[model samples]
Target: MARTPTASAGRRSRTKTVLMGGVYVALLGLVSLIIAVAVATAYLPSYGELTKRSDLGQMIRVRAANGAVLVSLGPSFGEWLPYAEIPAEMRAAMIAVEDKRFRSHLGVDPIGIARSVKVRVDSGRWRQGGSTITQQLARNIFLTNSRTFGRKVKEIILALAIERKFSKNQILELYLNRVYFGGGAYGIDAASRRFFGHSADHLSLGEAAIIAGLVKAPSNYAPTADAEASRQRSGVVLNSMVENGFISAAAAAAVDPAEIRIQQTTRENSVRYFTDWALPQLDTLIDETSDPIDVWTTLNPGMQAAADRAIDAHTPRGVQGALVAIDRDGAVRALVGGKDYVDSIYNRATQAERQPGSAFKLFVYLTALESGMKPTDTIVDSPVTIDGWTPRNATRTHLGPVTLREAFSRSINTVSAKIGAQLGFSTIADMARRFGITSQLSTFPSMVLGTSEVRLIDMTRAFASVANRGVAVTPYGIRKVITADGRLLYQHEQNEERVLVAPWVAAEMVDLLQSAVMGGTGSAAQIGRPVAGKTGTTSSNKDGWFIGFSSGLTTGVWMGRDDARAVGNLQGGTAPARAFSAFMRVAVANRPVEQFETQVPIPDWQLTPEEQMFGDVAIDGNVLESMVDEDGMPLDQPGQPPVDQPFLQPGRPGDPSQQELDQAFPPQQAPPRANQYPQRPPPQQDPRSQPPANPSDPGAQLP
Candidate 1:
């Protein structure tokens, strides 16, 4: 129909306006498309001619404790296997559990992202991850696990590039070979060999599912150790596979727990214990150096071999033992943590805390000697009661009166308890701590009977301090850590704190310990040279220990069952001492016979009137009264807890090996028993002095 001229003009103008707007919108859309293409191109990597890169550049070469080449390790702990060898079931399981639409997506999945976002919104927390298998592979290869926007963007970009560069099969192969599968295994092949004792291509369906489950959390779902968790996670994977059409529901249900067989892989390593202890220290260096490093340790191959031999010869079947030998300077020369490192990797030498038994008497006696008590002084060896706790001698009989040296030699429990009460339990604990004991100590009377637990390394370190003539010692294995290019990373420097004990006290203790080996429970440790040592057997013989030292070396040996089962009447003198003797015989085969410096210049061995009174009070069961207030009443409440004392200072400033051997290990010296005690130092206020106050008094404080 014909319209008015003005109306027709209006219609034409509106049409022209609509046309212009359409053109503008089209231009804007084309520009946006061009910009998006440019950005994607910039982010993409070169794909036409892929340069094969090696993953071995990050390998680390760990040296033996003695600086010899031990082994080289890659960033991952297993050999890489090609994708062609990975089981088809494993590939399907990974795809099902990790990325359901992996075949359809370019790199990422929008559906998965939207689902993860909905989960976070509904739960009000970001617990779910939407990362596809491609994104994870890209992160594993080119980025770290940092959760930042920049890293996530780079991960996405790399994933896209990887998809463009390699086929879907290649991407899946790389993921299978590089993903961790628990037990320090890095790939499918390594995981299969470690868990199933077979090749990747030979993996059963259940085994493959188990391996796939571990990729989520290795420690929590390892099939070998966490079998139940692995089973449950594998069931989840199988369900996902059924839903994704990778497997039938009936087939997925057929994967039985009983059908999954895990073969025990052979992992026999002689230095495994030492390596287990050294690896953590190496990791610290790796974090600092960010490169391969070499660790020079103090372990001696000869001594280590001898220790292994000693354990094998002395320990019976099913009985385990640990041995640690250190020089006077506290450098660990040899360490054997178990009868066989292959059977177990639990480091008993540094990890297990067992009763020292009579071996603990060393600290008790040392404490008494440090308090100005003479070795020849008498201590009544009789059963005594303190707060209803009575300690009896192991022999079930006690001599009426015995000298301190004789009491220590015989390891008389009653006498040790009496002395511990006289000096106070805190003093003994302090002395032991000063000697490098880090284990928690008991302050009860039973502590003198070795009721407390101690690590073998600590016990050995304590003996090492005595062997060094009261020099402070820190038992250490790492000598130095350097990079492959010789850049220094770490060095064990000797500390210069004053020795916690006096030289005279250490010498006297050495003399008494020497007498112990000569005529006491540790006689089995005697090796034709002057040896100072002690033997200890815990209640029911659950733990047997012989901690001894020669002029040149200090060593500790222990024999026990890991379950704390009694070893049929095994005493410290029988097996542990023999082991110590055997190890020392090989350890000192080339060194000349050296004598322990047992003589320190002192006055005649005579008890002072105060000491004699203290001894009498100890014998009469009035030990606390003897250390009484002026009113003849006990100064301390019966059940008052002991206060902690300041630890002993370090030794004189010098090299740990600078001590004169002439004085440290003389070839010929007077018998320790013949040497007289030096005149006691001028008496001063006891460093342990404190104000008398009620323990329950809130205002009372220990200083």
Candidate 2:
């Protein structure tokens, strides 16, 4: 190993060459960075534009159908707080979790980047981002969320520019105000008010930690989405705060996640589902608004509250229910997505597509009506076969011949199937389209039995058309939009009513629907006033529904589970109908009561004797005379009411209401024969009223 001077010289030369090559590479990288920054800067907004932060300052408020402020999405710029006013705990929690060395860093943190790279490498995934608060603010305001190397480079350059132009406090304030907090929330204040139901200044240590945790994955950890997941994420922030000395370890431990009170909405219950539905419509209605705007929705708060209560009271455990109420003009009055918005945000009213069961019969009947079928037309309730599918009545019994009105009110499957078969399934499907059902429908015979799945809103809207007297209704939630300066951004202007069927047909359908609520499966939906609706229970009891209209408002109720499992023995008549009545009682409490316009006698009022055998009201006097004992001694003490005692009066203590009776059978002229109604058998004669012969036997029956 003789090391000559030449060998030593060669090693030194190689070292110098390596150093020069590294220097050239470093210099080229620096020049490239400068070029990239210049290009990115050219694409960026002016400094004044960035500082103004208009997007951060703007918000959207949703109003009730009555114009009451329901909620505000985006930052509450009206209540925007200065850095000095923001809660110290919130600031500390944010600084500890989001950027530990925010104050010391210059727009970008090398240490943080190194840590992020190390974490991604160790975990084989991008577990965390290395962008500082300033970089996030820059990205949020000036760039789209494209996960590209170019975007990241621009983000860093813009962050540096922002840091140069603003102070640390200003950067923090802007970042806090501009950060997205999921659920259409854009700032700390809105998030605070939305989740904690208070101002940002009032956030507690635990609350602050939870809010800080929301920065990473707001939707996944939002209190409304998953309270448990939110709590765990908040715990991580609390630990981070402790590690950063922002809070003492003991203090963090004392804050129990379970005890945290998470108020999702300013109102105790949520109209979030309603807003969720309306927001997408906003996107389609308007391109974009530069300033904060107000969306005047068609939601009735009173009705919404009633809907909430009704669903809460009736929906069975482990199952869900939805209710949607619409006015004659298709204004969505009230909508309940689920019993609680926190448990589920998937709106069953507007989202879930379940079998409507017999509710879809509305289409079949409407088709028949348009095809010259009257409500009074005769239909056989006996078993019928369409293709190979045989339809059976829910009661497992059938009348030989029944009026169309009777068949509909009773939701007789055989009758509806036969009508569908006659009209052709495509005819019914076309009727459904005319009524506003946008979901795909089948032309199969079973579709008459509501085998086709549909959204509750679609069914409600379809019913709404019939309630609107055959005029088509397009269900809408937003009424108008306005800016803070009262400039109209959007206003709903109704065009001419699209007449889907003849008015008389709608009137006859109303007559049939009223009968259902009067004395049919939908009896549970009967309120004091007139109601026209139908009951729908799908096979295996998977879904129950009642869609009806009263006082110019159409309401539809659906009860089911999320997994499409059977809901025990739940039926539309009992749970959904009761819920509809309970909600309508309050929803229409203030609205004027109006009766549906119908042609007299509700069509087919005078079916043959065979038809009357199927429980017709208005019995023949001859039949009344025939109801007697074989003794033939006049069979009566004798003044006896014809027909059942309950049906003697339009409204008895336990009988259908007067409106139901009038709707059932409007009075025409006086009866031709006397004694048409033999008065009810005289009550056992009172002993005290009897003459002197009865006085001796006061305790005995009077002869």
Best by TM-score: 2
Give the candidate number with the greatest lDDT: 2
TM-score, predicted candidate 2 vs. hidden true structure: 0.57
User: Which residue pairs collide in model 2, if any?
Assistant: 376-603, 376-604, 639-679, 639-680, 640-678, 640-679, 641-679, 641-680
Each candidate's number of clashing pairs is 10, 8
Task: Give candidate 1's error at residue 347 in angstroms.
Answer: 1.4
lDDT of 1 by residue, 486-604 (tens): 77878877866445566777888998999999999889999988898999999999999999988679999999999999899799999999999999999988888888777665422
Report the Cα RMSD per candidate. Answer: 17.8, 16.7
Point out where model 1 deviates above 4 Å.
1-58, 71-268, 282-287, 602-703
